[model samples]
Target: MANKDVEIVKSSGKRVKFSFDKLRGSLKRAGADEKTINHILDIVRDELYQGISTKEIYNRAYALLKGKETFLASRYSLKKAIYNLGPTGFPFEKFIGAILKYSGYKVEIGKILNGLCVSHEVDVLAEKHSEFILVECKFHSEEGRNCNVKVPLYINSRYIDVKQKWNGINSNKPLTEGWVVTNTRFTVDAVKYGNCAGLHLLSWDYPKGNALKDRIDRVGLYPVTVSTLLSSEEKQFLLDRNIVLCRQLIEESFMLDHLGVSENRKQKIIHEINKLCNL
Candidate 1:
């Protein structure tokens, strides 16, 4: 048992004492059963050391799970997979569009809509029923990055501008809500301002049970980047072909064949993706 809190370094170079509760919570959230959780915890507890990085801890736990339960590892890597979608923010935008599209929203990505003051290229535009939502995706490659109040403040202005432009066109569906989604968490002040401005803010773990993580879990919409069987280049190749979601990958499984993937390897990959699709 880990009797004392272990100090660990984060990817952003911040140092903090690790909490077993946090690790346990993550495992539980990833759908690990109680027995598997305890087994992994026991093993990780034995290897605890001062100055171990969070990434190292995560890899240790992930490796343990991957050896036993493959899908659990993919689900556990949810946060990291979202991080892998970025560095350009375009794939992340496509990801958000896919999520919204699956949720019954008509989604358009990278649409250049003219605003009242100036033309703006919106990341995502979703129309469902009488509600049209403008979503701005904020993606960061580093861990522990926080989107601040300035982000919502800026996005709100952009949303209002676009809403005004559409309002003048006599469209049936009106822009109802503006959302700011990030792969990381938003600052307290950012959430505060968002709530005040009626902007729906989404993050990896924000909004309690209705976060981006929850939605992904609910919809079983794992990104192709979450595939453990596929290499980084393969994932990127799929992403470049706009096969961002696992559902899209299933539809475009021929892409794997085009990449010279063997039949047996393809079956393993399809099986892995099917497991995630059922998540």
Candidate 2:
């Protein structure tokens, strides 16, 4: 148990008392059984120290989980795996497109369109039934970041411009939904403005039960980056080949052979992904 007096620093540099429940909840979310969860908590508790960054705590817990169950560790490290998609938002945008496509949305990414006043480039355009959705994705490489009101404000204006032109062109009126998606959280004002302006805001944990994390968990549309068995170079290789989803990797297991991975290692990779994808 962390001492009530023990304060940990967040990635944002805010200091707060470390809560056992918070840590336990994260572990449980990774599908760890009660006994394993308790064991991880006990080990993490003993390693706790004042002013310890939450990142350190997470690392400790993840290491413990990995040592016990590799699959559990991969699931536990899902968020971190997302961060690894960066240095650029293109991969993140592709990731969002995959999620939407998997969820039955017809997705088009990085399209150029004419707005009412000017031509604009849309990050992702999703069409489902009578609705056409425009999504702008913000991917942050670092943790503890928040998308502020300015983001939605900017995205809203662009969507409004595009919506005017789009609605004018079609005889059959379609519902237009403008969305701002991020890998981080949103500021209170950002959420407020998004709701007020009728823009859908999505982040890792926002929108209560329908946030990105919820969608990923519900659909099991995890990125290939989430595989623990793949090394950094191997993961990058997969991503470079546009094999973003673990499901994609499963179908294209030939890529493993193309990379000249050993038969023994190939079997392990296949096993890890099959188990991770619940196959």
Candidate 3:
């Protein structure tokens, strides 16, 4: 007889039927080869229980991928890797600035701009030609936390104040736009409010085809947290020193020397970085 359907428990404790298609699709998006994906699916299928936690499944699949291809495994852990950006959101803000920079925009992190009624500290300021955008970066270390309506509400309030000031003084310049960027999903209310308020909202998987994850993958700007080869202390070392992106290591080769690992392991780490970054 065929094996009974397996129930997988999410981090929220909600249980649902296991989906091979979903698993395969995510693996593919992470750049896993077909052979490796099949092998992992087979392993998870055998180990399946009546009610297996999704975390367990992810860990198992990641472990298998790490052994086969460390870089692919890193890509698989992109979401968690983002959380490793900081004990605070400062590093994440810098990382986003870097991403925008890669896309040919001039980016500034931590700018103080004058608003209509008050001065505000902007998380990021990006400019391309005459277009200027003020961004608020919201970082969360935990999974499943959504950016809520209040976040956009507050950001829009600040943006309007600043835009009003800019318009009154610099009418010839391009109008300023506002965005609230998060590393997770957004609440339904948040999406509705952002739409109604005419503010741009960028999240992990929001706005259909054009989300933060999609943009990051489009430019191969994977962060250091994705690397399974790097231990927690090693990853922390890089993060503490402001080495957030995988491409940064490529740009500054000396950073690897600080890791103090064997040359062989270091080479493997470099190889993984190249594979993930498509270098």
Candidate 4:
């Protein structure tokens, strides 16, 4: 089969060409049914608008397939979609790492240490001044119910275990702080346990009370949105255009923009901004 060309505009406003043949080849290798592949392609073609990146097209296709009957089908579809897009997860890590570095912290990625060895790699380790922080990043469309408990357990097994080992080494170094950052909200019990254990948890939804933000600020690891991190010029452009591009960009990049921003809070902010701008 011949490659089908598509044009994508980058963030810098440069148009780059891509091909869909690789995606079709991947689907064929994955043994996807013809009907499904055609459906996905049709949806992508119908939905993708001007200036849409290949990554955006894939994300849209993934969201479309997620409504299907079989979980495996959805997973397969998403994997193919991501392949069509490009590298995503590590970019998110780097973005978050940059934020920490901006705030005067040393950031390390995929560091291996003498920890509990929880069977998975820790995303980022950050140190500032004299305090150590362990960050675990989860980049998923939606976090499951166990997402909260799982993070604490991983932190306890990894960071806490590493600290215990460190104590054995020096017995004087300070303990590392634990932080869990996810694309979805944390469970109520998870929040309660995290607070009690002095572990910092940041997620899509900030609990109703002031405590969550307070804890984040005090710990010097406040939740940051890509929107917040963007320069004033970018922010104004986003606001002026009412561009859903920010959300689309984050989704395509597999980044967490919804984290720490709840539906209610988002609505309120949009409302306030609209009122002030009289838009």
Candidate 5:
């Protein structure tokens, strides 16, 4: 347990206690064995400073976990790995598409749709049953960034234009919904606007326990970029070939061969993927 008096600083500039139980619980949830958890706890406890940043603590723990179990460390790196998709936002879009597909939704990405006023390029169009969702994927490379209100306001307007165009067709179409999904959190104003406008907002954590992270976890569709065992160059190799999920490796073991990894490393990657995907 953490000392009640020792305060740790968060990336958001908030001060909190260095809770060992919380850390242990998180590692446990990530599939760390008790032995590994105890080892990590002991190391972290000894290194705990008066005002250590949570990021530093997480880095320290991840390093240790990587040494103990590469796959579990990859699972622990999930949050940061999501942030690694950036600049072009292509990988993030593909990841979101994969999640929607896994959830039984037919998905289309980067489509230029004709709206009432003009042509708008939608990031993702997911259809399931009678519902159609036009998603605007707002990805941020930095942590603590937020999807602000203006984004939804703009997306809602574009959605209205597109829906009006559909009405002009005089044909039956699925009910269209607008969403602004991000890899980070949403601002208070953004939530307020989404509530007022009836827009769907998906962020890292919002709406209690049913956020994007929760949705992804529920489906067991984790991205390959989260694997600590894979080098950045190796990860890019998989990504370049449109391999997004680590689970994909199970089907195409030969893909690992292309990366020139050793047989032992390949077996470890396979083991991690199996454990993570619960297969």
Candidate 6:
């Protein structure tokens, strides 16, 4: 049985019915080319079965586009491809926002700043009691080797315009810190650049010898997981075993034993736990 729901409806008065052509039209409007559109449709048609929802159709299309190297041809294509991927990207921002919020900060997404002749869009802007934070969200397979340098470059190139427009306001006013969030781990050079630039960097994976706890402290963010949030017993078990670090969870052999759960059940349990806790 399919895990998702799909529905179909015939035309009603002025309302047109759903069709593959409609999907293609939508993709075209989003700036996808004919080849990309056809590729997306092929994936959907092959994977889709009866009763698939329109949203699921978009998700499959986005996933297919994400897998294509050509999708990275331009920023327009990147945005369209990401938009098609449903709300997965939002969670990356929201998770970081939650941590900031928990620490008594205000978080805003997609903040727009109009410069003298250009514009900039910041992913998540965080305002604490005394500091301002700018975050850029990137969901990639591997956090690029230049991920760290990239954040400062982006800030220097794009954010500088915003800053210049504001007429050199002091650091305490509108901008105080910068952050880059990625799915994969960061390279050592990237980490060093972040430290040098006074930027915070967060990723899904941690490097060797740098414990997750250590990385979280260095990045000024916490390592969060659905399992850690959902299961009180599991959380306590980890705490008792000194497994507060994500790297520890991944590297420490005793995690399963500490949780008193077998390896076979861990994956499913982790999935359900993440869903429940929103980690």
| Best candidate, TM-score | 2
Q: Candidate 3 at residue 159, lDDT?
A: 94
Q: Which portions of model 6 miss their true places by more than 4 Å?
A: 1-88, 141-148, 167-172, 205-279
Arrange candidates by TM-score, highest first: which order? 2, 1, 3, 5, 4, 6
lDDT, model 1: 0.90
lDDT of 6 by residue, 1-279 (tens): 322343442221222234777777656644467898888877776676654555556556655544553212221122222222223565456545655565688888778977656978777888877667777776543212224456556655565566566545545576766677665556677778766766666665444435322333344333323232225556446545544333345446457666667766666544433322224
Q: Which scores greater on TM-score, model 3 or model 5?
A: 3
- Which residue pairs show backbone clashes in model 4? 203-260, 204-259, 204-260
Q: Count backbone clashes in candidate 6.
A: 3
Q: Candidate 3, residues 43-97: lDDT per residue as tens digits?
A: 9888889878988999998888878877778888888789777668888998898
**TM-score of each prediction:** 0.95, 0.97, 0.93, 0.42, 0.90, 0.41
List candidate 1 stretches off by more than 4 Å.
none
Q: Write the candidate numbers in order of decreasing lDDT.
A: 1, 2, 3, 5, 6, 4
Clashes of 1: 0
Off by over 4 Å in 5: 12-22, 33-39
User: Which pairs clash inside model 5?
Assistant: none
lDDT by residue (165-249, candidate 2, tens digit) is: 9888964856379999999999999999999999999999989999998888777778888888888888889888888888899
**Candidate 3, which ten residues in sequence have the lowest lDDT sum?**
1-10
For model 4, give the 10-residue run with minimal summed lDDT. Answer: 78-87
Highest lDDT: give the candidate number.
Answer: 1
| Tens digit per residue, CA lDDT, model 5, 1-279 | 446667899766889877888899779867899999999988888888788888999999999988877778877888888887655789999888878888899999899989888999989988888678888888988776678888889989998888788656834665468888889888999999998999888898877688887776666678888877788888888877878887776778899998888999999888888777677
Q: Pull out the clashing pairs in model 3.
A: none
Per-candidate clashes come to: 0, 0, 0, 3, 0, 3
Alpha-carbon deviation at 35 in model 3, angstroms: 2.3
Please give the CA lDDT of all the candidate structures: 0.90, 0.89, 0.86, 0.50, 0.83, 0.53
Error of 1 at 47 (Å): 0.9
Write the residue-wise lDDT of candidate 1 on 116-229 in tens digits. 999999999898987788999999988877999999999999999988998888477778889999999899999999999999999998899999999998879998888889
